[model samples]
Target: MADREALINQLAASMGAGGYAQTKYEESRYDPDTGTLYCNGQIITRNTIDLAEGFYKNMQAKCDLKTPEGRQMAAIYQVGIEGISRLRRAEK
Candidate 1:
């Protein structure tokens, strides 16, 4: 509920302030207040949950999920997805 949304907002703010991105040498940002994601200073998405899920999925796709590193990330991604899903369901 509220806790989940707060956690997601914190994550988004951290990502934006740190300029995090999936790929190398690319800059990306997320503004939780506006639910906006920006990359290279351009608006890419307005849904922070989907943006985070997509980022993790893209990472999972690029790496081998069978490996320890990939598996670790996949597990984290699943938790994130679950959090997002819960929020969505609560909204409905």
Candidate 2:
């Protein structure tokens, strides 16, 4: 589907822009139907998702959420968790 192709292209482009090798991105695969993304022949797994979530929670608990700096740190971790969640939607 067009939407799937578009999502794949967008992901590859983002990864390329982030300094990842274009060849590696090209070799990667995205299955929109299953919402699974594979890079370097390794499938993103639920364990990775859980790790991200746990890391975010740990960071949140360690930070004083009331402080601006702490809130910023939490926001950063939240973004990482969100990105992982989006990439691993099939695991949900």
Candidate 3:
């Protein structure tokens, strides 16, 4: 697998001359007085994309959510992205 620790640097250096880079840290709260846990760092960008039409609008790509070629993109956004992935194992 690609080195995750180098994601931020690799992405940052691959941008154009005026491209901007921002590091995002996702946190989940359990309760007001209880506690919480931090997921990890993710890359957030103010970029736009054209889905169907030829028009472009400002949108958050959430690149970390998309997976390609066995890349661990989701892990990057695990901070705020949470879902019950079989919290309990199935019975035999």
lDDT of each: 0.60, 0.65, 0.28
Cα lDDT, model 2, residue 19: 21
lDDT of 2: 0.65
Pairs in clash, predicted candidate 3? none
Error in Å for residue 12 of model 2: 22
Of candidates 3 and 2, the better by TM-score: 2
Candidate 1 residue runs with Cα over 4 Å from true position:
1-46
TM agreement with the true structure for every prediction: 0.43, 0.50, 0.17
TM-score of candidate 1 against the unseen true structure: 0.43
Q: List where candidate 2 sits over 4 angstroms from the true fold.
A: 1-36, 40-43, 90-92
List model 1 lDDT by residue over 1-92, tens digit each. 97986676568558663333332246654455555545664554446567777886776667667799878887877777775565455444
Compose the digit string of candidate 2's lDDT tens values, residues 1-92.
97986677678557533322343557865554444456784555455656767888788778878999988998888788787667666445
Q: Write the per-residue lDDT of candidate 3 for residues 15-82, one digit (tens) a residue.
A: 63121222233352221121111223332221211121112111123343345722354343332222
- TM-score result, candidate 2: 0.50
Candidate 2 minimal-lDDT segment of 10 residues = 16-25
Provide the RMSD of all predictions against the true structure, rounded to 1 decimal.
Answer: 13.8, 10.8, 16.8
Backbone N/Cα/C clashes per model? 0, 0, 0
Model 3 deviation from native, Cα RMSD in Å: 16.8
Residue 41, candidate 2: Cα error in Å is 6.7
Which window of 10 residues has the lowest lDDT sum in candidate 3?
49-58
What's model 3's lDDT at 18? 20
